[model samples]
Target chain A: MKRKFLRRVVSGLLVLSVVAAAFTGCGSASASENSSKDSDSASYRTLDEIKESGTINIGVFSDKSPFGYVDENGDYAGYDVYLAEQIGKDLGVKINYVSTEAANRIEYLQTGKVDIILANFTVTEERAQEVDFANPYMNVALGVVSPENAVVTSLDDLKDDDEVIVISGTTAETYLTKNYPNIKLQKYDAYAEAKTAFENGNGVAWANDNTEVIAFANENPGYKVGIASLGEQDTIAPAVTKGNETLLKWLNEELETLGSQQFFHKDYEETLLDTYGADYEETLVVEGTK
Target chain B: MDFNVINEYIPLYKNALLLTLKIGWQGILVSLFIGLIGSAILYFRIKILKTFIGIYIEIFRNTPLLVQLFFIYFALPKIGIVLSAEVCGTLGLGLLGGAYMIETIRSGLESIPVIQRESAASLGLNEMQSLWHVILPQAISVSVPGLLANVIFLLKETSVFSTISLMDLMFTAKDLIGMYAKTIEALFLLVVFYLIMLLPISILGTILERRMRYGQFGD
Candidate 1:
């Protein structure tokens, strides 16, 4: 009896070890091959289900501010939180805000960890193929910031070994990799990590949305937006799953009506006004909500 | 699907593997030294020394290792007990490993028959001589297997030391994962690295245990 028990235990342990190895293999494959099967098989919960559940999980950055971030008192308070609240009220459901980083937003949405992603997710052709965008509430472009005196008009100026830091899932990563293949990237999943990594000489410059880079430059001395803009103006949107037609139709119609009145543009002016200030009004502002 | 991802991180994996081995060997060695000293407190039945070992074992075993590592690495600087990351990590690991080791080695020593000590007493061998010549050699041979097992445990425990920015195996893997977005590859490399350290120790323990079970009395 004793021998049998030990044999069972050992066999059980072997099975567990094999299972862990399998999970590790599966996860490794999925990590590198992100977005391959993502577009075709992404699951979408219907608008009615969201309403009946009485709660919508919206993924947003808890470490970022002026969009979504946790305050000193351990409460979630940001422009995105306020917007999410209003959207929740509009839909007559509770809002469950899931703290997310740039890298995990797509995964969180794909895995049904969130009903919508409003985490400053830039609308791009590559991303649009996977998750449907609900028209941009904000327009942005990739930008880089270095020390105040450093002037860089193009990415070619960066040394081959020198790195441009960016949050992992942000457009800056995509833009830099696509446009300037030679530049090394120091990527962090969180904004705070990228900021610290850049400040610690891990990278020569940090790039993100112009608004964020501008904010970084304004807050820190000896830093300026060296590369003020890159690529076309990209839109920031609230993304949902691809095939949820009811939610997709409702979101498009609501956004068009909202765009006509320009509620989001005013919200941006109110929420993002401090980050941009009057000096950045011309280049950074997307006057129309759409 | 590309194996290039694993190939690219080979340097990181190698560095991590070596660091883990370095820390793992040192941790177990320091722990063995401490366990020997600590078990003496329990073995000799010294009234005051027993209390001190009890306190030490309680303090180290009860407190969280992360907190202990933080106390050594960060808090010690305030009190002017500043130590290097390597020193602090090793010391923290030793203290934690010692708590468990003391019990293990002590139990191995205790498993000896009481009549053996009576035989030593009759031979005019004093307490210290008997302990050194008769008890310890047997205790160590029996205890070697358990101590080997804890060496594996200590190696695994070194993962907690990563938070101090020591760039141990897990830390290096995390850095690679951040760069490549291939968490699986990074973790797999770490798993393999850890297994290489542990599997040999485990196999050695099995052999030692079998040898001790049979050869313990010496024909």
Candidate 2:
């Protein structure tokens, strides 16, 4: 009798667990559908709406150094972060830094998680379809970094066994997969992991933004930026959710206004000068859009 | 929501599912081997090896698998112990699952009545023979359910293989979502593929558990 009761209780628990799993699975699917429907109507806070809240959430990469990264003081401090602060000041609102990875930048905007993305976000025609890009703030292109011993000077130099390390969702990954389909690419989700993997010799070389690889080679000894530029030159810009006309317009005007003062140049000198030096200042910094 | 995208992703998902299963089964086999050995050490009350196995269990059980994988893949290479991502994933899953398996099998071993050992000895069996013919069979039968649960658990834990860049199912799903932004379709297919992998094992586990509960196997 006791054994039978035990079996019954066990079966009951299993059934309950199965039902719970089914419910959770359906629940999430429906929830995401609802979110997508809501997004279709444009679920972004406008400029005045952001001011009304007194705080604007700006997504930035806490790991991408010199562009968007946390400083030694635990505060967000970088080229893009400096721009974010100025935008916050101009809008008369506080800035809430939301650390984001490259893969989730569009999702963050579409989900109403951030008012702006300033994490060295490169503007491409494809990305523009999902998020509205503001005027250019910086210039960037893909670059490869490798150890001093076996530097990857060109894509053809990579042999069959040579794997190139790339951070997922970056333009570098897209470019390589498109252009060099035969190259074996080891993709990491985070910048830090890719850097670590590269350092550990997991891959023959690392490909990323020219600014990033150049900065990495400069900062870390025994590494060199061998293919200083791989793809077409692209401009970095702040992004807002699609259909966020008010916020998008405000950002463009603000960037143009800042251009008069050479704000991004100042941002470069203050935040990126240490990593990139004065020689790259003019070439890397874009003072608003043409 | 997007059937077309799901249809498009089936081939990629198929390849990723195979990789996941390959790593999952390899890890399970390693854990089973480790668990049996560790539990046997404790069963026989081996002096130094028992203490070592006990510490191994405690350390692996206490730490998260992600940290372990990171250490093996990234940190260990700093100290001249380099492991590939695939090796690190299999080893991490095996080590973590082995810890739980050791405890599970130990409980089953201890649950064997003392008289069972004595009866085997009285029947002219030596210590090893008694353990081999009597104690282990009963203990393993009692342990089928727990072992199956651990197998399922280790399989689920393969989701973390993406962190080390192993190209598992979760990695494929995340990569698809990242590349296309077809979040709904990617996630829907992810759920379906996981169900395909896990549901059969789950149902089989239930049947095995029922059989063991009624003592049908040993008899």
Best by lDDT: 2
User: Worst lDDT window (10 residues) for model 1 chain A?
Assistant: A281-290
TM-score of model 2 (CA atoms): 0.91
Per-residue lDDT over B164-214 for candidate 2, one digit per residue giving the tens place of the 0 to 100 score? 878888888887776777766777678778877987787677767767766
TM-score of each: 0.68, 0.91
Error of 1 at A81 (Å): 2.0
- Whole-model lDDT, candidate 1? 0.74
Off by more than 4 A, model 1? A1-44, A72-74, A101-103, A120-290, B1-12, B42-56, B69-92, B113-129, B141-146, B158-197, B212-219
| Backbone-clash count (model 2) | 0
Give the per-residue lDDT of model 2 (tens digit) for A1-290.
45655675576567657755765676576567556744345468988889999999999999988788888999998889999999999999999999999888888997799999998899888788778999998899999999998888999988999999988888998888889999998988889998999888889999999999999999999999999998899999999988788899999999999998998888888998998889999889888775
CA deviation > 4 Å runs, candidate 2: A1-42, B213-219
Worst window of 10 by summed lDDT in candidate 2 chain B:
B210-219
